[model samples]
Target: MSESQNVIEIKDLDVRYGWGRHSVQVLHGVSLNVAAGCTVGVVGESGSGKSTLAKTLVGTLKPTRGTVMIDGVNVSSVRGADRLKLRRKVLQMIPQDPFSSLNPRHTIGQALAEALDPRHADVKKHRSVIAEWLERVKMPAEAMSRYPHEFSGGQRQRVAIARGLIPEPTVVIADEITSALDVSVQAEILSLIAGLRQELNLTMVFISHNLAVVRQVSDEVAVMYQGKVVEHSPTAELFNNPQHPYTQSLLRAVPGTPGFSIDPGITEHISHENRAIA
Candidate 1:
């Protein structure tokens, strides 16, 4: 996509945790571009830096080097009030664990209302708006009065989704939002996200470890290993012809693939391919 059509752009991003000698690099010279109205799946295993990337994009964590440009503003350069405003208006994140993310003390209505933009903070004035969003996420209007613990896992996630969209952000970063749910519930959540994306004209960055889930929802996919993006391409193309060894290994590791094996030679054979790609 053209630069003018891009909503998210990152270049040479590097992230390190801790100070001095104790520091460990988690992301290495990562780069990506997300076009407006497109869903890009960022796929990786545990500790592969997918969640770190999501945090960095949402301004919760700053990168050690490189730039994160969202809707023309450099995230790393913004400070204080500017950063707060950017997060509130431009981007929002739906975390993996809804039970932990939601405030147990707050009613569902209160939580959703708090997430609305300041201008819409008056719960009384925006009752219709809150109801609209709840309906959009397939929740009942009466759910507003209930507390988080009163609902099931899937219901809480639906509430979480409603909260994330309350502000009408341009970009939504969903970091493993469905991983905690059962397979049937996972399908329901994914279907909801797909429909919401179309109805709201949303741009999304979906972070997940499951290739099957990624393939189901993404228009494009970026495969990460260790701390680097090993492959990025249109979803179908990458699934059919992965150019990187790590990606191929991941595909082979998927359950039920014929002749799948934990062969040690696969890694040895792919080392040269890894070097070639690097």
Candidate 2:
């Protein structure tokens, strides 16, 4: 996509945990560009820095080096009110763990209302809005009075989705929102997100370890390994013609694929090859 079409642009992003001798780098010169009204899947194994990148995009974690530009604003450099404004209006995130993201003390209505932009003229009159969003996520309006524990995992995830979109943000970052659910439930949640994206013309960054799930919702895919994006391409192109050794290993590991197996020896061999290439 052209520069004008890009809604999110990251240049040489680096993230580290701790400081001094204890510091450990998580993202090394990671870069990506996501076009407006498109979905980009960030796929990798655990500790591949996928979640770290998601948090950086949402401004929850500051990058150690590099720039994260969201809709022309440098989120990493913003502070105080500017950061808050960006989070509330320009970007929103649906965390991987829905149960923990929602406070058990708060009712569903209260949780949803908290996410609504306070700048709205009728922010106090958000009951109708909450109900509308609940229904939009395929949940009953009565769910508003219930707490997080009262809902099923899928239902809670739906609530999480509602909360993320309630503010009508320009960008939505979903970090493994369906990983904890059953296969059927996963399909339902993915369908809901796809429908909402169509309706809102949303620009999204979908983070997941499941390549198949990512392929279902993304227009493009970026494959990460050991803190670096080894390959970035259109979803179909990546699947059909993965250029990097790490990308090929990832595809081979997917269940039901041609070489799928539970053999640890095979997995170890792939990992060794990937490390050598890196």
Candidate 3:
């Protein structure tokens, strides 16, 4: 992928946790490209390195080897102010665990304001943007003063989305963001993301174990297995005719017809993966 064209690009990416004797390889030379203003979903079972990839892209977990280019800069090499500059404008991560991701000490609005005014600008300067995002995420502006525990799972996820987008980032990495909510709520969040993508012109990487959810929101889908991208194709093409064994397994596990019941088997598989990650 051309450096100028991609919002985020990973080439021969390898990530390992621990060191020396305890080291375990998590991502094994995985490579992928995310185009500007597109939604690319990464699907895999637990221990498959989905979160590792997301964190690596956002400069949270640096890859032990290979290259991560965010908006044409090699993020793995940049540090301090330079690294912060790259991440602040180019890429952001919406963590899968909203409760942990959100600050319990601060009000929702305060957190949003921090993301909007990272340099400690006057809150008055960014109040309009904060209110706009609150409305966009379907939360009342008054909810800004509320704490994280006061909100339901779906609402917390909305707050997380609002925080990630408040900065108007060019790339968003949503790591299994819909897993915490009920199906109905999941659909609402999906629609919200779709709307935001159009409105913000965002390039998104949505990581999920649910093929159904990925199908609903992603333009292209990449099936990951054992720390590698097994297959990638346009969403419709991949759902209709998956090429990889894991991809076929994932599709077969989806329940009911198109727009029907999400398969229980798929949920079980995802649950299993979560345990592995934990």
> What TM-score does structure 3 among the candidates reach?
0.88
Q: Backbone collision count in every prediction?
A: 0, 0, 2
Model 3 segments beyond 4 Å from truth? 1-3, 254-278
Kindly provide the TM-score of model 2 when superposed on the true structure, using C-alpha atoms: 0.89
True-vs-predicted CA distance for residue 33, candidate 3, Å: 0.7
Rank ordering of all candidates by TM-score, starting from the highest:
1, 2, 3
TM-score of each: 0.90, 0.89, 0.88
Q: Pick the candidate with the highest TM-score.
A: 1
Task: Evaluate model 1: give its lDDT.
Answer: 0.85
Best model per lDDT: 2
lDDT of 2 by residue, 22-141 (tens): 999999999999999999999888888998998889887889999999999999788899889899889999988999999999899888888894555243479899999999999999
Q: Is candidate 1 or candidate 2 better by TM-score?
A: 1
Error of 1 at 154 (Å): 0.7
Q: Tell me the spans in candidate 1 whose CA falls farther than 4 Å from its real position.
A: 118-120, 256-278
Q: Evaluate residue 49 in candidate 3 and report its C-alpha lDDT on the 0 to 100 scale.
A: 81
